[model samples]
Target chain A: MSRTFYCRGQTGQQLLLGAYGALCRQVGLGRVKMFPRTEMLDLVVAGGRARGIVTRNLVTGIVEAHTADAVVLAAGGYANVFFLSTNARGANATSIWRSYRRGAGFANPCFIQVHPTCIPRSGDFQAKLTLISEALRNDGRVWVPKRRGDTRSPDAVPENERDYFLERMYPGYGNLAPRDLASRAAKRVCDHGCGVGPGGRGVYLDLTAAVAGLGEKVLCERYGNLFEIYERISGENPLHTPMRIYPAPHYTMGGLWVDYGLQSTIPGLFVLGEANFSDHGANRLGASALMQGLADGYFIIPYTLGEYFGGAALGEVSPSDRPFVEAAKEVEDRLARILAVQGKRTVDSFHRKLGAILWEHCGIIRNAAGLGAAVEKIRLLRAEFWENVLVPGDAADLNQELEKAGRVADYLELGELMCRDALAREESCGCHFREEFQTACGEALRDDRRFGHVAVWEHAEQEREPVRHVEPLTFETIIPAERSYK
Target chain B: MKFTLFIWRQRNRGDRGRFVKYELNDADPGMSFLEMLDFLNQRLIERGEEPVAFEHDCREGICGCCGMVVNGFPHGPEKGTTVCQLYLRHFQEGAHIHIEPWRSRVFPVIKDLVVDRSVLDRMMRAGGFISVPTGSAPEANTVPVPKEAAEVAMDAAACIGCGACVAACPNGAAALFVSARLGHLGLLPQGQPERERRAKAMIRRMDREGFGACGNHRECEAVCPKRISIRFIARANRDFLKAFFVHPGKA
Candidate 1:
């Protein structure tokens, strides 16, 4: 079959709406049931197999147990745990977290890809960061002023005085360098005090050269929506000014460990998209997210799920089944416990504090000291969250706070696991960078012999540490080697 | 920087809501409109009060998750801005902002600022999509859409489904949103096969959803965050007319 990279930039939204449209059509066809304002609260495992799910209606806050022959978690990534990510506000780790707790192995929990081109953070109250698509790099030459605090307009920063860092370092790729390399490069420049914008936390993705070369009209034809979005957020016209971008949390390469059939270790439990840790080894390339999501949803799941449903030794599940009853009670008790605390700090406050620990200690650059410190800090914060996090709303109505409380509670647990995953790797590979293991010239040094295994963490008892399992990555036809653009 | 925000507070679809005035002070001018709400919510939660339940996700204006009328404007005074994209700086210091939900009969209030806009989703299912099932397509480039047509399709395609159009439209018509889907697919050869079916099915579904007829007030275009034009409405009307005259099966 022939292949091509074709989309109008908003491919995910288009394809999702299309799939959603089809799903809605199925509802019309009486072939599918619709659940719009509902959220998966927990997984219901019966007879040592995945049987059903516990769900909460976001509108009424009514917790109900729905038994499925097989449960598929299409719930998205945990990037929102960062508190200021490019993820949707409602995106959380609760579904996957519950599944992990129910014995689905959480693989490579530390593998988060911070996208390079995003509008820089403005203030503390900023809920989410916006992304300037990767296409901007095609026309935008990334650079920082040679002098610290230059305070000169991008055009005024004379060519020699301006350091086109990407070109100077990775000359072959330059502006088109991959996401991970570009993100770290941008971070390196900013840490040195030469970054642009309000807090000096941005690098210039200057389209001046592109506009000059291809003419502004052509650039506008290609990137008008993106340029307009940049201008809308920053109040700076990119036709005249440069778009300031920084790396922000975009995708998590780590998720539920799925086997060859896209089913988790637990039978009848299937995971897809960003929820499952499959394909895209350290970093994800652009636009494949849409393709993979569509392919899995439209193609793979139908065939695989059919095979499972057809041949599996499954029994009709009742709401009174041990796992169903226990899971539902656990959710109810947890919510009751959170309300019982009556703490003073808002969920957002604790989330922000937790985010700071992870970002500062376990972000792009990581070392033994930082990772160890993060693990301890997350544990303490998680305790404080249960004791002092204030959730004001009752669990009866459409209470956003109550909803957030549940998600944040899961994040506290998931965030700690992420730090542990980061610490255990002990070598830099893909987006997982260990400060102690890098080359003298500073690129990710892969210790393939020791760490070329998918670190799968299984849940232990409440107080005990989670056990880690290794799935060694054995390449059949390809050989892993040093990645260099020079 | 301070503002008196009179937010409509409803317990549920059953509750008759009223405006509760909140005085927010020391609000950073840089915070987005939703962030200011977050500030209020944090304060409320600390005070043992139920924080305002508003609809929002992807707070970056694209997801169609956020919907509210701010001070008589659908997304506040900012032109071509969703409520999520509206910054606090746009309002003068100490201004009184009236925040309300989309007050259409079809889009009943869920709690406070959130209303059920799933009607649009239902209407789309009726025929908004091309008949092309997933993996049933030839290679994407094989269709070979004309550049100008694709551009127009994208322009119409830019509707974020925020329902600001319905709130802004005096007739409560969803023509702009409905037409965008029609125009987007109709302009492409891939959409040609299902053109009449789409127009017939979607229009029937929109009417069933109880939206008023388009009086062509053009209010929807005025408040569109993507600045989607009403030209697509005319294109949709043409498709509807053609479908009425000649059913593909009858012809």
Candidate 2:
């Protein structure tokens, strides 16, 4: 059996505060200067190394440059490219996307993790989906109505008529199945018109049996906050009725390619946390992300960074240098281009369209035909975005629309690249599930001999196809084994 | 659902902000407050108008990046709920909602509903953490903490640092916010050595940042999205009083 640690339902939040406290202490000691209310637009590479970054002040909207010895991007992942992901509203791929454009190798862009137990999207106007902690799966039984198109409430459905799908499919793991498998199973059932909740796009996560077995008091001690959150959002009590959950893009295992020292393909550019495509392979176990982030930030980077600083032959750099000035100008021009569009459709309208295309074709499952069509559709949509996307705000102000427009523009390109990556990988391995390459029982068929390598893509110039590079994997310690839940 | 929103609008930090009236006729009941605002902004953008600028990161309410006052309530009328989690269903159809930024002298408006909350970070920087060696993860059970103490610390640690407490306080005091951190660190065994230091330094920084002293109005406790009790403030005050005699100015 595996074990995990948590702080109730707020582990992520508590960990963030701890990290923020450490950062603030450094800021207080004058060791670190935090540039809050500022968004990075581009990475500054001088003499073939990352020297600084260009940022637009979110308050003033003025593009400026800051030079540094070694730039570390803890900028986070691009799961937001899916648009209705569990990521923050401001969470975008702009930082890493710009870095990719500047020569960082983006590895496995298609390996996006869709969490199984997220609060289902209520409507098209939903800003972001909330994730119900996976830990609840230990106590909650996942189910759906056996009868298709059954509109009865969860409590009203008879026990025999209910289909405990996870328990039936993978009897060994039951509700505790891995995220990718669980998410796909939920999708498969929903596709068969067996989904519960709103728009018939969710399954029931019933904790009633667990609560009855372990008493409400015991359950409350463990998941009180989560239950409260569920009630507040969906207006249904999990203790009284089962929670309706659906799969939503929660994390990305694909990011900037890094070596053993966490340095990206670009020298002097260190990537950390979810931003780097290190640690978690294609599918991540729950609570491991926190461990990986803490390990990188607290344990690993310090020594590696010290070694880098000690070994590198560096020169004095200034903000007025050619690279810095050029990067700033590039950022300014992009912002201006977005603002100058002044088209009929809103930036969000384009984002929603892009999200729909990605979700339908390149989501939990993928096929060559659908992916190829998606590529063509995205190309057309991106061109239209440049031509007709309305960004009605001044470039030199705290304009939310302008900020969104810039991020969406990057996503438009990145979304196409993600589809391209998905199309190129023919094997059904990890989260990149190619429908044509799966087993008879719907399990992902891994082709280790043919596809056991990281598909790293290099950004080509505009309107040109990106070149793909492979880093072959060699297992030295252990033999590769098939993952089975049966 | 439809509603008339009076949202604060400011071009930049220097502009005198004013509430701009917007009629959102097609807001769905299932939309969160932020999503409703997004719909409003989308319409405004289509109309060739600059959208209202509000700060939001995680719309799931954990990030503390989203904050705005709604109809005189800090995070709307929902108890222990952030504005991002507040749904349109909570409001009456065609409700006239007044949205504004956190009103505090220290938290000056950057633009519209976005305020500069760096002061809270400044106060935390004074002393919000326990000093530990930066290295590999330490062995578990090295320091056994009391169960009750850990529980209290966890409760205090739930603070999201959204500054709603400061915005809700009648005196514009950050006692609740500061006290939550103080209690979170102070109640732990690892936090013992610097306990007195933390209280004095954080309270001193609070005073230095031009925050008013708590007057026991309990307005802060009323609007805290996490429902952090004001009892943490009492604990912090006790620590601060003791800190005055123990470690006076060094921290």
Native contacts kept, each candidate: 0.67, 0.84
- TM per candidate comes to 0.96, 0.97
Q: Which candidate ranks first by DockQ, i.e. highest? A: 2
lDDT of 1 by residue, A1-486 (tens): 111222445767776666766677677777888888998999999988899999988888888898989999888889998988999998999999999999999999999999998999988877889988787787778999999888888888888999999988898888888888999999999899899988899999888877889998988777767776677677789988888999999999899999867899999999999999988777787777777787678778989999998998887889987778888999989888988889789989989998888888778888889888888998999899889888876777777887888999888899889898888989999888888899988999999999989999999976689999999999999899988976
In the order shown, the candidates' DockQ scores are 0.68, 0.77
Candidate 1, superposed: residue stretches over 4 Å from native = A1-8, B248-251
Query: Which 10-residue span in candidate 2 chain B carries the lowest summed lDDT?
Result: B131-140
What TM-score does candidate 1 get on C-alpha atoms?
Answer: 0.96
lDDT of 2 at B106: 86
Model 2 chain A: which ten-residue window has the lowest total lDDT? A1-10
The fnat score for candidate 1 comes to 0.67
lDDT of 2 by residue, A1-486 (tens): 332333567767776787788788788889889888889999999999999999998877888999999999998888888889998877788989999999999998998999998999888778788998877887889999999999998889999999999999999989888989999999999999999877899999999998889999988887788888888888888998999999999899999999988899988999998998888877877878888887888788998999999999989999999999999998898888887887798888888889999999999999999999999999999999999988876877777888888899999999999999999888888888999998899899888988899999999986788999999989999977878997
